[model samples]
Target: MLHKTELEYDANNHLFLDAYHDDAQPYLGLLIDIHGGGWFRGDKDKDADWATRLAQLGYEVLVPNYRLTPQVFYPEPLRDMDTLMTWIATSDFNQMPIGVVGSSAGGNMAVELAIRYGVPAVSLSGILDIDDWLTQHQAVEAAPGDLDRFNQQSSAAINQTGSNDAFYKWFVLNYFNQRTDELSAATPVHRISATTGPLFLANSLAEFVPTSGVLKLADALTSVQVPFVLNVLPGNRHAKGYLDDIFSQITAFLATYLIDQRPKPQLATE
Candidate 1:
């Protein structure tokens, strides 16, 4: 919690982000931290610890916030996340070798960025496949007519154990608006390809998202021959910590992929 620093940003929706970096180095790579809060109710505070730790590990970190539901929905947040990524990339904000890390809602975005931008990333207990997630919610009443009915149904879903039902319900309704037709555009697994970057995925088999989803993502990555690893923790599906026990391996993985990745010079051409 010490040696913390924050940066100011205005996303034009009254949304802002707190940025931090390894000030010890004049120039450094970047790790963008996205906090998980059911996509509708979380902020950078959720991942500040992660940002701080990544900074200690010698990477500049950017933890951002996105405009959410009621005013906007699914694709909007995706665009917001992309805007931050693009800003960093073009600005070259003082470094190179950019990467992403997210948990829960944020985890989904991190994986999406990895797919979209082709950069190394990690997702902890992420809701990567949303259509599948809704199918598994068990409590969500599909397309509950109007917003009032939708809210009522989701209110019940909010109580489903380990489901994190409220967030799931809101994310869907806010985006698709009462339509259960399909979520192809929002699902990350369907978009994975050989060009996707290396990934480190971890999940706890408890509440919130399904462990099976994590395995499915891992399976897809393996099938494509993309370099990636999956770590399954005991039983805590909704767990997230960048400075906890599991982070040790995460650190090692990213250190190799993000920090150490640089072009090697060919033997001196005489």
Candidate 2:
């Protein structure tokens, strides 16, 4: 019943996206699932199973591969996402309601897109406040036995130095080209407005990503009176690491905004 097809969104760059849907039934809405790899490495295929599961629930899902850092920097990947959104807007599915869900770095972009496009979004362990995080946390090496605990609880691969802070900061610097001045501008917490769409944010209590950024984002969303839900589970698992436990709730939140509240298409009378 589920079908998947790959379509090119950026022909010039040879980038393609995988689309998933059920051929037997009308889809409820469009959902974009963005994969996370600290911005330098990751493929859409990594999220294929997750997209298939959402498609089985009556949603059309798209997973796109974006340009990564080193070869590209901060806004290039974001531009790739913008291009995908533009392609969708001009396609046959333009009339369908849409939403977005992402993990880690992808989650950061999802929140930005939700604000940019006014669509519901879900973020799993997103790095929401880069500027604040950089200021508050240092790239310290793991203490005695800390590496073992991090390895036990997290899905992230430890960098060569065995330091969580150093590993995370490395990716951030790569994405930004080591420029710290503009981080606040790219930070989602600093960009929230009254027009921003509803958001569902989930994070581990003490993951490689500091929980402080998530809380700061929540506070900003509250200050703007935007609707949002925050779920902090107990562990160090990041992003999709704990996704299975909260997936049903994520879909339900998306359904409330994208499907339940939208007007169903009516069949024409003969």
Candidate 3:
């Protein structure tokens, strides 16, 4: 009952849209799936099953492969997703409400996308602030093994083009751009505004990404009165096995929030 297809992309290499629709009728809605492998590894195929389930629910789906770490960094991922959303607004998918679902780093990107572009987002334990890990401050220290994984997988490593210290400087410079103001720019906490769109957050109580990040995000949304939902699932391991109950809750949330909003009109402009 679902049809699959690819989305042609532009020269910037910002977007790739893989879609699914019903065989007998047109697509009723769309969800963009952003995979999370700590911003370094993850692809559309890895998320196809999630997309497929949404498609089965009568919503079209797009799983885009964006520039990854060790190749691109920071704003590149956010920019890629933003451009893709703009492109989607002009495709056949135009005229339907758009929703995005991201995990881990992708979850961070999802919240950032909604903050910067006004797209509705559903994040499953996403990294909301890069500074929570990058800035070598006296924050909650990561365990030794976890720190090793962080070093290898953090988006900052994408720009490691020189010696260790130099690469770190490049990562920090590229991220903060030599200005203190830019620090906030790179942090989703700094981007929150009253106009920010809806966010549905799901966090594993056991995940070390910090419950505080989710709490901070939820507080901001609440302060600004942006429509949002937060689900803290206790005892679940860090983004562990596909919990069907969580998935069902996510699908229901998307259906309720996205079912009626209209997509952009796709009339070609000469």
Write the candidate numbers in order of decreasing TM-score. 2, 1, 3
Question: How does candidate 3 score on lDDT?
Answer: 0.67
lDDT by residue (tens digit), candidate 1, 1-270:
234555445446655677676666543467888876655665677666777778876777888878765566677878888778766756646357878888767788889988998888888877776677777675865332222322221122222345455655665555656566657667888889998888888876555457776788888998899899888776443536322757888888787887555556589777
Residues 73-166, model 3: lDDT tens digits: 6677777887887787777777778888887677888888788767788887676645554565434332212223332322222222222333
Clash totals in order: 2, 0, 4
Q: Ten-residue segment with the worst summed lDDT in candidate 2?
A: 144-153
Candidate 2's displacement at residue 244, Å, is 1.3
Clashing pairs in 3: 70-158, 95-263, 95-264, 96-263
Give the alpha carbon lDDT tens digit for every residue of 1-270 in model 2.
Answer: 988999999987788999999988778899999887778777788777678889998999999999987788988888899999999999977888999998888899899899898889999888786887777766553232233323222334323222267667767877898888888888888788998889999988767677776788789889999888899988677777787899989988998888644777799999
Better of 1 and 2 by lDDT: 2
Task: Please tell me which predicted candidate would have the highest lDDT against the true structure.
Answer: 2
TM-score, structure 2 vs. true: 0.88
Which is the leading candidate under TM-score? 2
| Residue pairs in candidate 1 whose N, alpha carbon or C atoms collide under 3 angstroms | 162-208, 206-237
Q: Is candidate 2 or candidate 3 better by lDDT?
A: 2
